[model samples]
Target: MIEKQSLPSAPILIESIRSIGYSFETAIADLIDNSISAKATRIDILSIPNEEPYIIIFDNGNGMNKVELEEAMRLGSKNPNEVREENDLGRFGLGLKSASLSQCRNLTVVSKKDGKLSAFSWNLDYVIERNSWSILEYSEEEIMQLENIELFKDVETGTYVLLKKFDKIQASTLEINKTITEKMSSTIDHLALVFHRYLDDGVEIYVNNRKIESIDPFLTKNKATQAKRTQEIKIGESIIKVKPYILPHYNKLSEDDLKKVGGKEDLRKNQGFYIYRNKRLIIWGTWFRLSRQDELSKLARVMVEIPNSLDDVWGIDIKKSTANIPDIIKKNLYSCIEESVFTSKEVYRYRGRKENNSEKYNYVWDRIKTRDGYEYRINRDLPQIQLLSKNFDKDVLIEFERLLKNIEKSFPTNTVYLDVADGKLKNDSEMSAEEIDELIMAFEDSLNKCQELGLNVIEFYEQIIKTEPYCNNEKLKELMKEKIKKYE
Candidate 1:
């Protein structure tokens, strides 16, 4: 028979778990996950940055009883392999302990339920001093002595997690208030982004008495944002939703609008795939190595929504900060990349027409590279250009052709290429509500002209629907159908 040996000392094991990689922001986020899983509608974080700073997070969640509280403090409280509730945001069960202990030496959790309060704590200093695994149960009087513990005095049910002796966050010799203020800014932004969907659904998060607001990366509410048709992919029992968005041209956005979607990073760097697990953003700003990041595709962002059930399929990690897109979805996404990229380029190329008086040009100029170097050619068959050419005299036409050739020769192809490669290309576009309205108005006028020319309504509909601008709009096609039926 083999004899079982006890694990390492309690202090050694506890300290080891604390060393797991968790930044100040991520650690707080992990605690917030617990608050959410507890069905908390309101979460308040209070950090007092004195010499002996304490970070307190209190949530109006389903507070645990004495039995449940003890169980919750146990290491590996729940198996990662075990099935969990659909809304539960935890895995490995070590987040509460490891995340809290990473920054502080003492972690105290106080709960109020059924008009009674219970408090418990895990102190690394106590463990090291006693050399034993033990939990320190606090008396109601003792708990009340702690700063901000009075918050739960009158509440019916809620949980408060207090982190004391913030060694990691206060490591620097800098002034405590300044350090805390600087870190709070990033923490606020991260919490707003990670819990954006929750915030939208009416969950309130307050830090230092200030409420946190959600920042929508999709810009879905903006009238100028272009949405591609949604696609769905199945991975076993789970269905992953995919929706692509082309953000409005920068020129159309005010300064405040820019900061709301872009945050502190340049909007270009914030592009690519945004993975949301249960409507909370986890992995983002990546293409999963399927394609390179291009300036042209900066306006292109793909939203991939996955339920918590697919956590294993997507390789969700302990921190829940990163994930891998499954192989099955990769093929479909790659196949659609070309079309998405083309739409993105069109958004980039169409820049200056947002202004009311700006002249709109729809010239498609192809730049070709041969062994001799580069050449540019305008598509002379374009309807607008062809119509203009009919009004030119012979000598005037010769001069026009010479001018087009001169413009092509001076195209600055290499300069443009280098600028795009260096991420210096200005991402402004001519697309706006005005442009779409003008397009529809022009199509309606053209239909009236064709009617006066004695063209058959059906023939006119068939030809016009296949032409520029009209072909791009499905609603316009339906409108044309209505007009043709009215005329008949």
Candidate 2:
């Protein structure tokens, strides 16, 4: 038999995964994941930036014991290739170690369970000094030092991770703290929505003493009264329930409103889909490959919730803040999301008519291409009398005969034309001067009626005459001259 030799202890490679690669946002998100998994109903995140910036993540959840605390600090010790329970929030179990290390050189976890308090800490400098992986157990005196910390007082049972010597935070000064607070305020607002049901309890998440407010991108609170139709669909075995909401038109939204129902305005950067894994938000913004189209840009936020077991399907990384939706789910999601977009677009179009008077002229109005010039198209087959003159106005119709008479002398062209098949104008017939005046008066009266009905007759007529000039007949000048003299 060959002699079996034991291999030397493998040196702990210190350079492989340093704690500086992860962004501050991703690191904080990871810490929150642990809290959520612990069944924390309330979570408080506190950051004090100064000469020595520090971060504290406190949660009201089942705390860990001494042994569990020690094991939790050992990197890569998580049981591999093992199936987790349905309620388990951990997938790879590297979140706490990796996320904590990525943000600070020193990490301390304090917890109370079974009527006992225990704590564990990992000091990177100390590990590098000894060139080994070791967890420092908190002494009775050290625990006393932490007990005085405000966040730890009055907590029945929970775990708190204190990140100090924040060498990884991009901004560590007091000035930077202001900016971080602003950014975190927006981030927490979105988080509240991701785990709304959990946060709505008496437990509150305070950022700098201000409670976080949930901003529902779907406008579910106001949607009941404003939505025209609401539908829900149960998809696949996951029972992924999709709630389709059709929002009110743009006009219905308050003039001072910053959010529009079913609109993507709420999903950009700080406001999009808040992906939650086991009641913790892991991602924000649109999932890769899914973009906000113009029609859907206003209503793009669609929150997707998955149990921790589906972490592999979502490509959840160790940071627990970014994820990629699998192709299987994306296939079904595309159709549902598309339908929601189409519904919103139709509602916008229909409600626009009911709310705005200008919508009625959408078809006939010549959208002036330039201040000095205009381009017009008569899409309808109706006879049109477009006036390219600068003086076109509603009051011009009051002196319609006078204006036509002036045109007969100055331009000597038929200011009006007859569309033999169209109802816009009457057919021209041989008549005495008196009869021509009556006809002109009747036509002018009809146009004034259109104006009263809020129709843009001037714009409509401008388009028609520009497309089909009134001088279709060569004798149109003579007819105009006769009508002008008779009117005078």
Candidate 3:
């Protein structure tokens, strides 16, 4: 078989590139990726909204010379299989052109390097007129005359991308200026989250001269946020880092706290795995079918960090908007999913309670979940049980444990549910003076028994006050505290 010379029609290919599934926000983010990879500490995005609108992204990154600029302006500058630097964010090298022209008809790029400047542009009208893949190169004087080219006047080295003639956006709307303004406004939030780590580490991004604050989705700084230990998964020669974070219970979070990672709406929408390639978020709010998104796990968010070397293994797409998790990777992440999901459930289990931690609260009953179903068992750690266990012998203790288990198994769940549904669940009556005196006498007897068994009387006294029935009766609690002071 001989290879024949067959080329894609320039006009058709250009239009095809414009339809490569890029939204306005995603297109701007794609261009910013190039800036970050260039080691630029600061990036500025400027939008000019008018009848013939244009947008400019200027970065102080290591700008290219004439030849490098020419190559970068090409459709496919670098092969995907080629090895890139550890920090390089480019995958198919089609981001700059494809992302820019996807929203506009004309794309121009001007760069400053080594005290010299160069500019080049791809005009869709000219390409369609000539029916050839061609670019317009500019002289020093012509480059100086370009709109917003003065942004690089004092820069040591940087690159400027200018997008003009938003034909598609104009065709879709009567008010082109307002639409572009809104699009840029939404892009700010996307950039804030996608590059949050970078921004936290001192890299600054400005939109229309306003500095954007990083939006930390994990709330890593919040004291209440539970950050599980980082786990590493080794594949071939690289290591994929995984760290799971459980957000605070909704009631525990303040309004300002919610605003940081967007609002309550974003909490559920941004749950699940957040895949990042070299500190830049690629995809998020998905479990990749490893797990389902449920209300119990809404607070769970896992951060999976992979390097560019493993790009092939992850199947990262051209837009970097989605990924495919391999079976091996999914298996390794099973433990993390189980842990984060369990913790998130616990948050709901104790919600609206005085204390969130089970160990801290001395509840009379324990609600335990098992594979079969939920079990409503009496709490065996109560002061009454401890006092009785200290006095009972081995055979007596065995009989007592069996009795407790039988009571737990015989819980009236259906009766309670029906009562609750019918609004007939009665509240306990207030304890009278006689009842308080009787409970005090019973507790004093237990305290005497604990002392006779050589147990710490003060310990038993403290537990008696914290335990229920006695804890609920304020009169009995005050009398017990007065009597227990002598034991202390």
Give the candidate number with the greatest TM-score.
Answer: 3
Which regions of candidate 2 deviate over 4 angstroms? 1-16, 19-21, 85-87, 150-153, 170-187, 201-203, 224-237, 246-251, 254-274, 287-292, 358-488
lDDT of 3 by residue, 82-125 (tens): 99999999989799999999999999999999999999999999
Positional deviation of 80 in candidate 3, in angstroms? 0.7
Per-residue lDDT, model 1, residue 244, is: 85
TM-score result, candidate 3: 0.79
lDDT (CA) per prediction: 0.78, 0.57, 0.87
Comparison by lDDT, 2 against 3, better one: 3
| Candidate 2 structure lDDT | 0.57
Evaluate residue 35 in candidate 3 and report its C-alpha lDDT on the 0 to 100 scale. Answer: 96
Q: Candidate 1 residues 252-350, lDDT tens each?
A: 777776887774357778778889888778988788888778777788888888988888888998888788776888998765554565556656765
RMSD of each predicted structure: 13.5, 13.6, 8.0
Model 3 weakest 10-residue run by lDDT = 352-361
Q: Tell me model 3's lDDT, rounded to 2 decimals.
A: 0.87
Ranking of predictions according to lDDT: 3, 1, 2
Clashes of each: 3, 9, 0
Candidate 2 residue-wise lDDT, 234-257, digit = tens: 334443433344444545555423
Which stretch of 10 consecutive residues in model 1 shows the poorest summed lDDT?
353-362
